[model samples]
Target: MAGRKRRTLTAPARIVLCLLLAGISGYFLYHCALDVLTTFQLKEQIAQNKSQISELEDEQTALQEQKEKLQDPEYLKYMVRGKYLVTKDGEQVFKLPTTQDDS
Candidate 1:
């Protein structure tokens, strides 16, 4: 009968290999979770930014209309009188009373 030797890894080598595999798997899992979180955050940020952009565009349009209105002398005079209580020369200023009661 011939004798055969069995091949086996040492305890330290096995432990090291196990720790290495664990470390690699942990790193992969961590990065995968982080990637998901980052993607979610980016999507949220994009939606928020889009909303902000829409609001800014609306404001810009309103401002443009206001600018056009201000370019007209009659519109400017009306705005100044309504907003600032200002009157032109020889113009009579009248104040209207509000009918709403303050509770």
Candidate 2:
């Protein structure tokens, strides 16, 4: 009987196969790690943005209340006097002495 021929991979073929598998695995691992890091960063940003949004909303409410107050005649007069140093008709204004002028 004739001897059977054995089929085997050459050394170069084995090396190429190993390198291809390693490259594919490395690519998958790299992308997975990047995705995890990106998700964490996005979650942190969302949390920060939510806090900022709440703070801005609170400020907006306060500003709305102040707007309502300013629409009133009495409050508007008071605010104008305090902010612009304006006086109403026949209203005497008092000025405080500055600390630097005490010398």
Candidate 3:
């Protein structure tokens, strides 16, 4: 037709089209990269929490064992004697030589 010339993509139009597409794709990729980074950070946090929880659980088990041991009268007496160095009546406590040398 006389009025309509053509509807083809010229060189400049193609360049602009390519640039637009690149800009849009770059934005999308940037957002996705941010998400990936956030996910990695969250995973690291979760791993740290898991390790802390494991350590706490181990400490709890040790404390429970200690609690059970403390419930025994003999263990309590032994702890007291070890700490206070007190001996039974009519028992002599000899002072041992010091292992440290006073150089």
Candidate 4:
């Protein structure tokens, strides 16, 4: 009996060893999968942020161009005349109704 005990693991001991190994493997796999998912999510967020930054930069460029245009006297005069209906001396003011075609 002593020699037999030394030669092989008992059935319950074998089961416990297998269960421990499986548990440890499962734990590591779960964490690895979680980390991979987190990395993908972070990468996706970074891509979205990059695209948004590019859009904002394009908008900033457009706004800068508009600001420069606003500084021009002729353009400013045109905008004022069109938007506020301002007229120079001896200029006839006409009120025209805007027609919208909804197709």
Candidate 5:
């Protein structure tokens, strides 16, 4: 009871200080929310890219195998015959309707 009362901010000063603090807090909250959203989006994009990369790698492997097969004359002959319906000389080809759509 003997100590002097501490000087406090006036009503207008207190209001202004509170308003400034609220503005700063809101700005920080908005920025933090934005960061979280951006992180989520980027993670999703990374996952999609990783899956795409794996798919492309698998396709590349398959294409490499096909290329290897093409280097062999027997496989090439079989592939051409099967895919293009080409035949050797004096060979007969029969065209049949497929059960499923071939294309």
Candidate 6:
């Protein structure tokens, strides 16, 4: 093996080798860029989902508090009287009219 001369590539063979290496590198680079973009989009989606979850949790807490308040009979009566305008027996209800302006 020591006595044998080393073999070298010709110009055409070196060109083909370089092109092959470049093609492989380009293929891997394209997939890597796609993966990076997908990761960024998924992270944005996760952040949006997290904010939505927090908003829903806050709404749930508020609804729970409202539910607890509604369980009280006095608060329930007050709400019915104020919102539904329910009057007790032999009670008179009054209404005020508002004027509207047209353009």
What is the C-alpha lDDT profile of model 1 across 1-103, one tens digit per residue? 2688888999999999999999999999999999999999999999999999999999999999989999999998888899899987898888888798789
Clashes of 4: 0
Give the Cα lDDT of each candidate.
Answer: 0.95, 0.94, 0.94, 0.97, 0.97, 0.97
Strongest candidate by TM-score: 6
The sequence of per-residue lDDT tens digits that candidate 4 reaches over residues 50-97 is: 999999999999999999999999999999999899999999989889
Clashing pairs in 4: none
RMSD of 1: 3.3
Q: Candidate 5, residues 25-93: lDDT per residue as tens digits?
A: 999999999999999999999999999999999999999999999999999999899889999899999
Worst 10 residues of 4 by lDDT: 1-10
Q: Output the TM-score of candidate 4.
A: 0.82
Clashing pairs in 5: none
Candidate 2, 41-96: lDDT as tens digits: 99999999999999999999999999999899999988889878898689888888
RMSD of 3: 4.3
RMSD of 4: 3.5
**Model 5 worst lDDT run, 10 consecutive residues:** 93-102
Q: What are the clash counts of all predictions, listed in order?
A: 0, 0, 0, 0, 0, 0
**At residue 40, what lDDT does model 1 achieve?**
100
Which regions in candidate 6 have their CA more than 4 angstroms from the true location? Answer: 96-103
Q: How high a TM-score does candidate 5 get?
A: 0.85
Residue 66 in model 4: lDDT: 98
Judge candidate 6 at residue 29 and give its lDDT: 100
Q: On residues 36-96, what C-alpha lDDT tens digit does candidate 6 reach at each position?
A: 9999999999999999999999999999999999999999999998789899999887867
